[model samples]
Target chain A: DAGITQSPRHKVTETGTPVTLRCHQTENHRYMYWYRQDPGHGLRLIHYSYGVKDTDKGEVSDGYSVSRSKTEDFLLTLESATSSQTSVYFCAIRDSGRGGELFFGEGSRLTVL
Target chain B: GQQVMQIPQYQHVQEGEDFTTYCNSSTTLSNIQWYKQRPGGHPVFLIQLVKSGEVKKQKRLTFQFGEAKKNSSLHITATQTTDVGTYFCAGGPTGAQKLVFGQGTRLTINP
Candidate 1:
């Protein structure tokens, strides 16, 4: 149970609509990551931020964008939703002081129609 | 692109039976970590193995890292209903900040 919270725990949006999921953390960890979980595909990294305003794309960053303007909040945005994007999104913070173990949020379930 | 491949997408076993899952990586890994996710819950870290040919045990669960640093396995003894979940193996490549996760193996137990 990390001090991580994901806004909009569950969301359903129509195709081609703009959607954004927010992740907020109080742990003050330097690394934050956005991951999407799909059945049979495990968890795929979408984007990650090492510090304020510092971000990098992951393996499955296509059609998605992320912003980390502050150390406590990281945002993942899907400019136009698609059915293919429907999945459970999870936000995680890495404790670099340790062995880089990740503490994940409860997750946000998004359904695109 | 480093890839971690896990086998046996799903498994069904009766209570008290044993279960195992295997993971292989396309490249050498600096470390390997294991996580378990119960149904409808987020994944939780279980353990990590950093040395080649390393083996660690936690209660009834055992984790092994291959000698080549490119493979790992998790074995659980006497499975129970509480052991039902998806197990994922994530590999951290050398000098990489991110981990590449396998597809995961879902374990279902009949009590």
Candidate 2:
């Protein structure tokens, strides 16, 4: 295990509301990623951080923002939730020790009403 | 942008049957990795293939990478009830930082 934890295991928010999900890791891994999983879409990356204060957008970055002020914490925020944003979000840390393997946190299931 | 496509969006097999899923990419990849997500669970790393025409096996699961590095496959033998879930193949392009994942193949095993 990577000792990763995601806050708010489940959430139900109305469309147009703001929501933020937190990913905290205790392993001190250098790469952290945020992904959303939906039926038929697999897991799509939303954002990722390579180091403190260094972040980049991923394939499905629309309507999502991420921040990493510390090596152990990465946050993903939806400025305004949408019905289409309802999905299970996952946070993962690349295990360089094993070379290219990612250990994922327990996912966060978000529902937009 | 890179795209990884997986086939047979869904599959159902008897407990003792064999099952396989394929993943293809239009562009060549540097390395390919496979992940499995059990129902209601997060994706977990299963294996990573770095060299072309490479084949690796774990217990009852076998993973292979194409000669051109543009495709991959996972085959499971004597499937069991625990095999029910979705299998995803992901790859990163040369010098790319993020991985693109295939749509995945959902497997259902019947008793």
Candidate 3:
């Protein structure tokens, strides 16, 4: 219960369409991360933001981009949806004081047809 | 890239039985953390172990960090039906805040 929220809990889009998922937090955390969970891959980071307008690519950044214009909001966008991109996406905020433990949102399940 | 591997991808146990899952990392870790995700729910932070050969317990759940700092284990004593879900171990490398998570072990409890 870290006061994190993810919009569009579920989505289904056609291939080649653009989709954006939003993550909003009220805890005023300094670090925000986007991750995707698949059957065998587990949770793979796509992007992370350390501060407003400061972001970095993660292990699985291909075909995905992120932006954080404010401390409370982080956005992840899929430029062109692909079948391989069909997975559950999670938004997390790092608890700097707690051994770098992350608090995750409810998650968004996206399906590409 | 650092990789954290978990064994026994799937586990089935009867209520009151004991269960354990292991996680291994290819590189040394500065700290390790455990998370649990209930069925159709998000991952929730459980505990963190920083020092080598550290052991911590939360009721029936016991978490341990290996002496080498590259392995970790989560053991549940007298498993309950509520323990049905996936358990993940994430490792934070030395001098970095980023964490690499293990694939996770999905536990199914037979009521």
Worst 10 residues of 3 chain B by lDDT: B91-100
Residue range with the least summed lDDT across 10 consecutive positions in model 2 chain B:
B92-101
**lDDT (tens digit, per residue) of candidate 1 on A24-47:** 999999999999999999999999
Q: Give all candidates' CA lDDT scores.
A: 0.96, 0.93, 0.94
Question: Measured with DockQ on alpha carbons, how good is candidate 2?
Answer: 0.87
Candidate 2 error regions (>4 Å): none
How far off is residue A14 in model 2, in Å? Answer: 1.2
TM-score of 3: 0.98
* Local error of candidate 2 at residue A48 (angstroms): 0.8
DockQ (model 3, Cα): 0.89
Per-model DockQ = 0.89, 0.87, 0.89
Locate the minimum summed-lDDT window of 10 residues in model 2 chain A: A94-103
Query: Per-residue lDDT of B2-102 in model 1, one digit per residue for the tens?
Result: 99999889999999999999999999999999999999999999999999999999999999999999999999999989999999999878768788999
TM-score of each model's chain B: 0.99, 0.98, 0.98
Per residue, candidate 3 scores C-alpha lDDT tens digits across B1-111 of 889999889999999999999999999999999999999999999999999999999999999999999999999999999899999999978877678999999999998
